[model samples]
Target: MVMQTDTVLQKMSEDDFMAVFTLGRKLGQGRFGTVFLSVEKSTGREYACKLIEKRKLVTCEDVRDLRREIQIMRHLNANPNVASIRDAYEDSKAVYIVMEFCSGGELFDGIKERGCYTEKEAAKLVRTIVAVVQGFHSLGVMHRDLKPENFLFLHHQEDSPLKIIDFGSSTFFLPGESFRDVVGSPYYVAPEVLQKHYGPEVDIWSAGVILYVLLSGVPPFWAKTEKEIYQEVLHGDLDFSSEPWPVISESAKDLMRRMLDKNPATRIATGEVLSHPWVRINGIAPDKLINS
Candidate 1:
């Protein structure tokens, strides 16, 4: 049945937020939206549906991203590392994006519970992140918002791979386009991005931050506020003495340092990430993946 819209705004989505959206409970909620653990009423298959109020949408900059996200996710659905959007629709008050549901919580919870990755597990995670970044670049799309919270879990038969979720912050930066828009979690942001000159390399920077978090069990730097964090990011601060990280490989540390470099022009090359010292330890290709 087509949705009834007798008195909704043109861009206004479904006000029947409670009456229509189906599946499970509220999983994550942010300033402008909420994601629910939902199921396709017909197929009974599970999905993570993020519901965003159309009127509450912030930033004219967000409009393009909102539309682009739908387009990009459609094109990127087959990639193993990226989450698949099962379906999407707009209602009288909000837009409903039904995406693949990953039962395991964000990496943030995992880190809190497990402390940090064993070198082996951390390597596996980083490889997955690198592979995803490589895939996105190949498609000309950039996930400007990559962080531990956006990282998810999915069982690919044997075990789950770290899946990248929440593309609301992603954007399509055309060739030769140096993005000046300042967005993304303060801790995972690239120095160049914070400095207002970046390209796809910023994704690599965020990926490197994820690697740092997994291996070191904390962000490279910590501060009391967003401004302070950005300042630390601007300066590219890394704490060698941060506890629980002494055993982290020097090569891994080298990779983080290069990935987090203050200069975008001098940052590690895209193809070189998989070959970095951290990714090439013990003469193996760091998980040697040909991820499906």
Candidate 2:
């Protein structure tokens, strides 16, 4: 069931609040907040409580961004592939956003630890992400930031479910509407985003970068500085002659090309990505090592 977004900010009685949940170790920190592992005393359920200091939101824009993140999270309730908010509380000092705890950690760490992934494994991971993108598109939500660091596995299992987190960069768009905000991580940012006009296709570009990195263990566009990286992205230089390229199938490369097309007008849609042969292939390799 979908939770009410407005009620999430309502102040409750002290007897029914913070005392119920035991905050644990520091999970991670972002630009404006820190996430802590929290557990409920009554049910023993675990959650990630994101604490955002009110003092940091010194301007109107800062406050709007934080509220946008919470609003987007609350609206996309109960999606298996997207993180859901369990509760939200605010005090004079900070705003606490309690969300589902993803124990398997960042997809970036998963990729880094393993070094690389096979086509089948990469396809499975991309499929989950594309499915979530499709859902969000239908709901008019745009996950402006789509990268390995934003995805997390639900458990420590090899085939655990993947969940997308960090909605601070997400925003809603109407049909045929677009955004001009130049937001998103440098390497994953689309050309149109740099041009200051873009739609949901920016996400497809970022996802392509993730797929490329999963198979090659590196980014498609890389340089020493953010400026150089953005320049490479604008130039749209893609390399497939590396060590791993010989092993990857042409179908996979084809999808990446379509996803990372310089023109957003011609980029592959999320629905098309899900049906691509590279993403649809499912194989059983008994000898393949399962890397979590």
Instruction: Give me the candidate number with maximum TM-score.
Output: 2
lDDT of each: 0.72, 0.83
TM-scores, one per candidate: 0.84, 0.90
Q: What 10-residue stretch in candidate 2 is worst by lDDT? A: 1-10
Off by over 4 Å in 1: 1-21, 58-61, 111-116, 155-158, 280-292
The sequence of per-residue lDDT tens digits that candidate 1 reaches over residues 47-160 is 888887767665654555677777889989999878888767776556777788888777656545554335655666777788888888888889988888888777423366
Each prediction's RMSD to truth = 5.4, 4.6
lDDT of 2 by residue, 71-115 (tens): 899889868898889878766566788899999989877655665
For model 2, what is the alpha-carbon lDDT of residue 36? Answer: 97
